[model samples]
Target: CVGGSNGGVKIEVVDQGIGIPQDDLPRIFEEFVQLEEADQRGTGLGLPISRRLAKLLGGTLEAESLPGVGSTFCLSLPAAHPTG
Candidate 1:
């Protein structure tokens, strides 16, 4: 889902699966960081790389999760207005 904000737009990607632990949330975006319970096959570089790219484009990336519920990855970016 997507929504408008004061200075930007919020884009959310929500999932319905085993949620991430509270303790692991902080490092979820770090290089090679992955929870054992999650996909062990993953190299865990995706999130960190994505975050860096977002920042380079003048945006922010974040995640929120609830145990056994689900997780949501949010990306906020400034709105682009066309100019004549």
Candidate 2:
């Protein structure tokens, strides 16, 4: 209302875990992407799929990280206006 534009909903996820490596940053949004040598097990399509769905809904999915510090992921979605 202030800017004559709708403000979207914001979603943020942060982890104090080991964080991410510099190299894997690029492919994090790609399908079948994972931190190589990661001792875990999974298809690694989660983020890619999430990003796709967000895009379809006029939203955005993104992430940020600091090697040994932590990481944060955010999702923004258009708000649904109420109908009288």
Candidate 3:
């Protein structure tokens, strides 16, 4: 889902896969950090890199999840302004 909010763009991505634990949410954005229970093998740089890129673009990336339900990721970018 994508829409406008607070004079900016709010994009949300939702997944039905295994949700992340509240305790691990903050660590997930760290470099080379992966959950022990994760099934896939990865270097764990994805979220960290993504967040850095979003920050460079003047945006923010965040997540919310429930133990058994799912997860939601939101990327919010500032609205574009026309240059004279």
TM per candidate comes to 0.80, 0.81, 0.82
Best by TM-score: 3
Reference-based lDDT, each prediction: 0.84, 0.80, 0.87
lDDT of 3 at 75: 90
As for model 1, its CA RMSD to the true structure in angstroms is: 3.0
As a whole number from 0 to 100, the lDDT of residue 61 in candidate 3 is: 90
- At residue 22, candidate 3 shows an lDDT of 97
Alpha carbon RMSD to native, model 3:
2.6
Off by over 4 Å in 1: 1-3, 37-40, 81-84
Most lDDT-accurate candidate: 3
State how far residue 57 of model 2 sits from its true place (Å): 0.4
Show where candidate 2 strays beyond 4 Å: 1-5, 81-84
Instruction: Encode model 2's per-residue lDDT on 17-72: one tens digit a residue.
Output: 88888777768898887686767767989999999998898888888889889998
Flag the better candidate by TM-score, 1 or 3: 3
If the candidates were sorted by their lDDT against the true structure, best first, what order would they fall in? Answer: 3, 1, 2
Better of 2 and 3 by lDDT: 3
